[model samples]
Target: MDFVDLEPEIPDSIQVSRDIVYKETDQRSLKLDIYKDEFLVEPAPVIIFIHGGSWTTGGKEDYLIYCLAYAQKGYVTASLSYRFSQEAIFPAAVEDIICGIRWIKAHASEYGIDSSKVALVGGSAGGHLAMLAAYTADESYFASGCDENAVSTAVQAIVNIYGPSDLTTDFAVAQGATPKFMGATYDVNPDIYKVASPITYITPDDPPTLTLHGTIDKIVPITQSDFLDKALITNDVIHEYHRLKGWSHTMDASVPVNEYAQKVMTRFFNEWLNGDD
Candidate 1:
């Protein structure tokens, strides 16, 4: 499915820069769309958005509205495109996200973003990348092919919308995308599955995370978020999990459930990214 070229309902104060190339690999170029409200103070907090297509499809174009929504709320938002599993598997997508964060920080001054106050927000496959990227900042396992820099890739907060947290579970095994993305099954490559799971990297030093999951989600079960929540609590990391009752994966804004999720996500970002708690 193609994403509509629909612009978000943004105020005149907001300005958007489209199709900015953030990284160049030997295989492909990674790009991102940046949005910022000029009315906000200089050096605004940044929000990095990762698009979800189960690691094989989707692009930054699909998330322009989401980027603008956060930009309208006084942030410099970037919706990034990464290498898909079809082109490169396992750590390739994660490495691309890391490089995107580095590119954002390296160009922070030019983009009016504060390098220290960045957050990540994603849904589904993108959510998995966001959480893994944020949690594995100190690990070198998935850092391959990423930019070599002293600049930290750790995000201040994360807003995950029904992302898969554990890759070794039955839920992941049931999904064809998982094996394709990992290039092997849990039994065949147990270490790869464990390393890719965000639940393996959680620590107290990790940033506050907010997860919103639909109880009736069919693609990624609610148990995925439950696994992440348990790890966050065990490590004493600040986090919140909101279980959307009688809801499914596709959450259009016209739906009350999505509206509520937007409110919660906004508040969560305000608390952690904007220091408004």
Candidate 2:
């Protein structure tokens, strides 16, 4: 599908607020864009999207379609921008996301957001960060500079699309972006790679997870999601995996593939974010 095919005609009923600063750091102001129904009377569940760019590029605008679609579906959606690997190292992006979540929850009333029914969604590197932030909500390592007790970072659901689960894996170790993001080679700091891996924090108590990956993906590889699936299963966590066949990384860029993902994600979010367990 062409890129134009992915652009939907956003209805007037849906409102968009762009470049809302969620955090202010010495380096820059982290921002996010929010989408919601203008006439929403009741508080709605929130879905935050993180964009993929090997942890070095991309922005909140990358998931505009997702935010609009979910907003029209009676949910408040946000796409956040975090510090890239080029500007900051490993935990910086993670920390920024946690801060973004906390900011969203803190200002939930302004946006008619149901703070308790929040979820995180991301693709590729974004997915990895989403998983890390969601799974380690209670861990202080990532919440270092923020007031950890002020607002909770815990989310109800997680959606990982072609995201790498274990950075310590051979594939991840060999990736140039992986080491760059970590600020060290796997040989120099294996522990950092392990700590940054989303699989490391998986537990039965973690939020329900949904993962989608193309079997033919050469970038992140299908094995990343496979490893995540296995770990989630072993932990008895509620999880779903969609291994799309004959597709490559960023397969969602295709209209049909994106639509399929939207369908699956809508169902997953509705079930887990609506008190359905």
Candidate 3:
């Protein structure tokens, strides 16, 4: 990931801490940008956001505005960064995400975040990482040098935006993105692909999920979310699926659709993360 080329204008009412190092290894250091309403009381619910750039591009800077929007809504939100495919392969991004959550928990008191009420929000490739990270919320997956037992990486809920839930599916294998991230095609690394897929970890005890997908997404088909929705139902895991008809992969093309999706996401996060539900 690279530095955010531009930053969003932050309102005075929101408190922000940019580029805080979450993990530092011999190779590189991972950072995150945090936003929270200054007036928010202690034990505030937190949201960790992951950006989408096909798992190869994008960084915390890309999602500043999105994070701030959630902060303004009274949640402590962090825009997190992870290793790209060029730097490392599968499970590396996953480990970084888990580390980010643990870092947040380790410093929960200073940040005034309610560690137990955290939520994961990501779009595109970030969405995939968010789902996989939340599902693999165990100590064994912690990154090297990070304390696995410092705090649970488990999230109370997840908001996945057009992420591929199953990499073994025809659409995912044909898309080439999953293969690139996994370091090989499914035929050669079926086990890795299965371990990387979030759909494979769905269980009755999994956190509630909210998925939004554009019907005409060329990169990641809406069927990905459809399959996840079905699995969630089969496991009796509470969830909501929003299918944006006539829309494509990126939400920028349709203003109304983007705004509506944001509204839905905001409501879902507020209800689940803020303990309103």
Predicted structure with the largest lDDT when compared to the true one: 2
**lDDT, candidate 1, 89-126, per-residue tens:** 88899989998898898889988999999999888999
**Once superposed on the true structure, which residue ranges of model 2 sit more than 4 Å away at CA?**
2-9, 147-149, 275-277
**Candidate numbers, best lDDT first, in rank order:** 2, 1, 3
Regions more than 4 Å wrong, model 3 = 1-7, 139-145, 252-254, 275-277
Candidate 2 per-residue lDDT, tens place, 1-277, comes to 5543445777889988889988888789889999998998899999999999999998888888888888988999999999998899988999999988998999899999999999999999999999999989967766546543478888999999999999998989999999899999999989999999999999899999999999999999999999999999999999999999998999988878888999999889879888221
lDDT of 2 at 137: 91
Please say which candidate is ahead in lDDT: 2 or 3: 2
Superposed on all Cα atoms, the candidates' RMSDs to the truth, in angstroms, are: 2.8, 1.9, 3.6
Candidate numbers sorted by TM-score from highest down: 2, 1, 3
Please state the error at residue 8 of candidate 1 in Å: 3.2
Using all chains and alpha carbons, the TM-scores for the candidates as numbered come to 0.93, 0.96, 0.92
Per-residue lDDT over 189-255 for candidate 3, one digit per residue giving the tens place of the 0 to 100 score: 7887777889988889898899989899988888899999999999999999999887778663255
Q: Model 2: how far is 147 from its true place, Å?
A: 5.7
Per-residue error (Å), model 2, residue 158: 0.5
